[model samples]
Target: MIVEGKVVKLGDKIDTDVIIPAKHLKYTDPSYLAQHVLEPLDPEFHKKAAEGVIIVAGRLFGTGSSREQAAIALKAAGVKAIIAESFARIFFRNAINNGLPVLACREVTAYVHDGDEVAVDLRSGEVLVKNRGVSIKCGRLPELILNILLRGGLVEYLKSAVN
Candidate 1:
């Protein structure tokens, strides 16, 4: 999917707690998770962060947590992809497993900023920086992850695996 939005910039080491506060975990449904996504960062985050907007963050984004709900929260909140300098392995895997597109870029955070409308090419792993005359390069996704994403997520892939 091609996403264009004003970035809601975040710093390094954004963890699951920041994505979805622990207080809301009582419910199993991911719908609640979306409500609390990034609530800690901005009480009105849900209202301000438009759906299909891209979340741009520094290193270690999605660190310090392994819960799948974290990815679900972002997805449900309409976050299309997370562009970060680095990400926690578990969270990265969780994102793709849940059909959430994530890309790793070391220099993206430096060139990107809040409220900057950028275009994300998920298939190409490139970000066309609007008016900056620059493009952020995100390395290619693994074949395994691509296959899962192409199938609409890991579960769907598994269902078709035996065919």
Candidate 2:
């Protein structure tokens, strides 16, 4: 499972509300949430990140109320992957549960830049570094979690395991 896209760098300590403001949670449909991803903070984000972008953020990312909608909105908004220094527990689970890859690494912020073209290979556990056409070695996830991602989230993982 390798997700590649243009990097979109966000600052530190961004919670769910900041990712998708709570005021817009009235609708239950994922599309509704997707349309307004970061709409409040940056109205043009959707336009720029139309084809799925790789979001890079600082530590303690996704810190806030446990709203799965936040993860849903990101997926719907076409954010194929997110690389953060760390993730709130619930948010981390929610992301993988929904089939969107959220990776935690100490130096992700250092390796990626806004608009850098990058690919995250969960199977290999490395965020393949691609910048100005240059490739570098960076954060690698655990093989255990990589297997979970390949199965497409925990629910699917469980189903396969049970079967």
Candidate 3:
């Protein structure tokens, strides 16, 4: 699978609370959660994210809280993928479970600037920063996880499997 989008750059240790504030946790609906997604970190994120953006962040992105809603909110808000130097374990799993592709590329954060176009190839684990003409290597997702994302998350993947 391949995903392409404009980049939304972020810094280190962006925790779950910053991804979706605790106060907004009352809403379970994906669209509702999306409205408040990253509101604390970037007030204009929702507007910019609505057009399908890819997040590029520094190390330990998604460092606090294990709430799956954080991933759901990002996906609903139109975040195509996230390329970070590193990720908190739970957040990485939650993101994949929700069909939000997250890649860890040690050098991606340095070359990716906000609004730059990026294309990620899941099969090859290559992240291309279009404007800069740069390509960074990332770990490829295992086939099972890739299939889950291709089906739009675990639930959808299971549904197809049962058929």
Candidate 4:
């Protein structure tokens, strides 16, 4: 699968709390969580993300809390994908489990800037920065993970498998 969007740059160690603060975790509804996604880090994130953006962040992104809501909120807010230097293990799994494609490209942040148009090919793990004419390689997701994402998260994948 391929995901293309304008970039939304962020720094290191963005945790679950900042992604969707606990105060807003009252509901598991994605749309509701989207409204509060990154409210602590960027007050206008909801509006900016609604227009479809890809987040590119530094190492240890999603470093705190294992709440799956962070991934849900981001996906609902129209974040097509997230490219980070590295991710907290649980967050990475949670992202894929929620059908939020995340790529780990060590040099991605170097090539992408905020608002730059980029395209990500999940199968090839290539991150192309359109305006700059640069491509960064990230680890390709395994077929099983890809299948889960394609089916729209773990639960859906499981449901389909059983049927």
Candidate 5:
């Protein structure tokens, strides 16, 4: 899958709590949860994300609790993909399970600025910074993960298999 979006830059160690604070977990509605995403870090994050973005961040992005809500909220908020130096293992899986494309490209954050347009080829692990005419390589998603994302998450993939 290939995703293109404007960048939404964030720093290292952005935790699940900041992704979707606990106070808002009471509501399972994704749109509602999306309204508060990264509230602690950036009050306008949800607004920016709503415009469709590719989050570029430093190491340990998603380094907190194991709530899948974090991934859900991001996807619902219109985060097309995420490129970080590294990601918490659980969050990585959750993102794929929720059909949110995420890649770990250490060079991405430094090269791409907020609002810069980028195109990501998940199958090739290539991130193309449109404004700079640069391409950075990240670890390619395995075929299984790619398949899941293509089908729009795990549940949809599984359902298709059973048919």
Candidate 6:
């Protein structure tokens, strides 16, 4: 999959609570949850995400609780993909399981900036900064993970296979 969108930059060690604060956990609706996503970090994150964006975050993105809601909120809010220096293991898997693509590029934070247009090629693991004319390499998505994302998450992928 190839995803292109404006960047939404965030710092390191952003935990699940910051992604979707605990106060909003009562809601199961993805759209409703999205409205409060990253509220602690940026009050206008929902507005920016609604316009479609690619989140570029520093090391250890998604470092806390393994709530699937974090990924759901982001995907529902129109985050095409996330490029981070590193990711917490559970969050990484949860992202893919929710049909949200995530990439890790150690050099990504050094080159990309907030609001810059970028294109991410999951198959090739290439991130192109459209405004800067720069390319960064990220870890490639394995075929299994790609399959899950292509079918719009694990449940859908399994349903299709069983059908």
Q: What is candidate 6's CA lDDT for residue 79?
A: 91
Q: Which stretches of candidate 4 lie over 4 Å from their true place?
A: none
Q: Tens digits of per-residue lDDT for model 5 on 45-91?
A: 88888889999999998998989889999999999999999999999
Question: Given candidate 6, what's the lDDT at residue 25?
Answer: 84
> By TM-score, is 3 or 5 better?
5
- For model 4, residues 46-107, the per-residue Cα lDDT tens digits are 99999999999999988888788999999999999999999999999999999999988899
Structural similarity to truth (TM-score) of each candidate: 0.91, 0.85, 0.93, 0.95, 0.94, 0.95
List all candidate RMSDs to the true structure: 1.7, 2.3, 1.5, 1.1, 1.3, 1.2
Pairs of residues at least 3 apart in sequence or in different chains that clash in candidate 4: none
Per-residue alpha-carbon lDDT of candidate 1 for residues 1-163, written as tens digits (9 for 90 to 100): 6667668788999998888887877765866787788888886777665456788899898987677888888888888778999999999988988888888999988899887788888788889878575788788888888778767778888788866
Error of 2 at 120 (Å): 1.1
lDDT of each: 0.82, 0.81, 0.90, 0.91, 0.90, 0.91
lDDT of 6 at 143: 90
Clash count per candidate: 0, 0, 0, 0, 0, 0
- Clashes counted in candidate 5 amount to 0
User: Which pairs, if any, clash in model 3?
Assistant: none
lDDT of 5 at 82: 94
TM-score of 5: 0.94
lDDT of 1: 0.82
User: Model 2 scores what on Cα lDDT?
Assistant: 0.81
In Å, residue 85's CA in model 6 sits off its true spot by 0.4
TM-score-based ranking? 4, 6, 5, 3, 1, 2
TM-score of model number 6: 0.95
